[model samples]
Target: MAGEITETGELYSPYVGLVYMFNLIVGTGALTMPKAFATAGWLVSLVLLVFLGFMSFVTTTFVMEAMAAANAQLRWKRMETHKEEDDDDDDSSTASDSDILTPDSYERAEKQPILSVQRRTSPNLFEITDRVEMGQMASMFFNKVGVNLFYFCIIIYLYGDLAIYASAVPFSLMQVTCSTTDNDSCGVETDAKYNDTDLCWGPLRRVDAYHIYLAIFTLLLGPFTFFDVQKTKYLQILTSLMRWIAFAIMIVLALVRIGKGHGEGHPPLADPSGLRNLLGVCVYSFMCQHSLPSLVTPVSSKRYLTRLVFLDYVLILAFYGLLSFTAIFCFRGDSLMDMYTLNFARCDVVGLAAVRLFLGLFPVFTISTNFPIIAVTLRNNWKTLFHREGGTYPWVVDRVVFPTITLVPPVLVAFCTHDLESLVGITGAYAGTGIQFVIPAFLVYHCRKDTQVTFGYGTVNKHRSPFHHTFWVGFVLLWAFSCFFFVTANIVLSETKL
Candidate 1:
């Protein structure tokens, strides 16, 4: 089956696409950022976040440029296929979906998409209308081993994202419902690192309550993986609205506390000890490269596409700075929670049951919506990876087994531990790095070479990145490796620090 395609005439305005991109990048990562900022020192966090955001933007362009090249190549083959089919009388012959256009695939030119798709594949390299997802591009440029590596990194990243959602929703539910009244419950004054053995309802331990909630979350969202789940336009709007309201409330409340001269944070200018976690958190917050094809393909206009993306990043950086800075200063550095919204549940910051209720359940509403979708995507990826052309699967294996595997590992992960910070940190440190920096860098570099070979050196790709140089590509790769080493060292040193 074809991947989700944003059709040509149904494209969104460039500005509208900005909102979607913004929404995509600023997800659960934002919720976990304030703690990292507070711990790392506001000044240090600010510089790191800004730099990371810029790096993510650089990679975003890299992915977009590669996408356009892919589109151009597809269009070229469609043109060639058009000529061959015209010369033959077999109008019923169709291209095999597995046939990807490359130097090797040239001999089997009959198995390429024909010019019937030309309207969707525009002549202007910048105005690529076909929905060439990242997976397709990886196959187009990379050899078998390279493609497998790409999928592995992506699968790991998706699992990390799912695990976060699985754990976060239950953890949030436990905190909110258990915090109020009921002495048998793990009540309001439980320690920051409350354990599973603590008192919950009746004979239930704190961990029992968390696991119970996780089970409930799994039952509710996990089954959606058995089928397909697409977030409708209405669902997107609602999620976006809730996000804006929750974030706006958080920033405003922090500013209010700061304005009253009640700010408690007095962080150092920089802390070498906290930089590693801070880097991971900031990298997670600025992520969007993986979802770029879905975001960029639908945009109707090409003019100022890069500028619009830069502006969106600027806005996001400002938002994160405003949110994290306000949070660090308004709340004491040491007192900040991993899930920042929980801090407002205190009597001092916010007293209204409505505000606390809304903020407290924010993750439940948002992450719940996303969990099943990611699960389904991972399940689909599994099928794609192991799939053979002209092969089929038993119904039980396709429907029951794939979803079961996808659902179990992450839920079991949440069952074992609910440390959102460690989950996000590890996820961002490794898979997140690959998605944001390494994959995009490699994809663009190899894509540039492929484009030249396929279209000849003289064919200028109009949509190539402004940072279209070998040095930029090398810089991105070096930076990715440096980050990998830093995170590895941090993990080892952290283990020793204990």
Candidate 2:
């Protein structure tokens, strides 16, 4: 009763901890990282991956530490309240303001500590709610009112840019397979009478505008489904598993592509401009903020959080570094969107067909996994607006909202633009900059406090440090500027078509 309980009601803290860690790493990023590598050369992308993992660890540790301190403060206050209650019991004649206070007022007094701690420690609703709120803001900005529209615009831009790259995985497979397999006539250049344009099998393509719109819609829908937390657990679990499976598939594709020597015609590392462009894209895509809430859970211990973060970063870096190097070494083209598996399939290499199948299935799995996130977001917002509890609403909304939100826009966007690379670039430039970089810095800075100690020189000794103030101030300025410059540069460059 005092601690965590297993299925048979047995206390097992370690099991609980492991479960939390599992949930933390399973998400959209796991599915998308492989695709992102297609844009930036594998080497550069790997470096960014390592960097993001490190940043994630540091930020998560800080967040956990702050949460722990807040919890301690709450416990101390509760103990004081209990002591006061005991004192009141001893003094029978003392009937205080509580006797005159209404039930609502009394309840408000009881909730004061909780509210204070929440205000002091939580930077955004996402931290408190265990959901991503920025996605909602982006969704609204882009699809709804378009007011203070810069953020939404940027997000749409980045989404489009990244989608272009993502779409190429399927396209590459089609092109490579068709071009290499049928050798009926070597060096045949004539337009044959049997050339059936209708039978021309190509990669699945989507329009840029449609991709951006779909990304925004899905982004909106993901966080909303968390409103009905109890009913959505199954959906969350399924999506998480799919994400991991997709990762596994991606890993297989990467290995096979590397073994086949695919990067025969890739751009040279000596070309600094291309390298820079690749680096910029990698940084933009990898530094995503959506995963932060998962990383910093209230239940995680500060020490464990810090250690795990470090471990996660190291693993991420190693994986990405290996992946990127192998990819670039194997891919043989200057195209930004090199689907490694597709390129390998062109050689008719062993296991290439299976790799292509996995790569093709990977995107569908991503779409499925992404749906839950979108649903959770939309559900949460609806709850906020209507002030309804989980049981109060229809189960259909809880079950269907995520899938609907996720599937709808992509279906619509399928008609607009199929360029995945441009979609991804635009999304990185626009939404990625703000959601990943700016908001967290603002929350840390705005909620920072100064430490104070009271001391009596002769009878008492107390010392205080304004550590929080200095830390937050410096961190805020540093990250804020970085976010601003990154977003600004993205917008400017994108607008000018640089």
Q: Which one wins on TM-score?
A: 1
Stretches of candidate 2 exceeding 4 Å from the true structure: 1-3, 6-49, 73-265, 270-302, 335-347, 350-355, 382-415, 425-430, 450-480
Q: Give the per-residue lDDT of model 2 (tens digit) for 31-83.
A: 33433465444555555556555544444443433333333334434544765
* Candidate 1 lDDT by residue in tens digits, 1-498: 123334643577888889889999999999889888877887888888988999998999999999988887787778568656653654443576323333334543335433333223334854568888889999998999888888898889989999999999988888876643534222353236555576768888777888889988888888898999887879888988999999999999989999999788777788888877788888888888888888888787767899999999999999999898898888777777778887777666776768877888898998888887898899998888878889998999999988888888888888888888778988898899999999999999988777655544545566778898889999999999999999999889989999
TM-score of 1: 0.90
* Candidate 2 structure, TM-score to reference: 0.58
For model 2, the run of ten residues with the poorest summed lDDT: 452-461
Instruction: Give the true-structure RMSD of model 1.
Output: 5.9
Error of 2 at 144 (Å): 21
Candidate lDDT values, in order: 0.81, 0.41
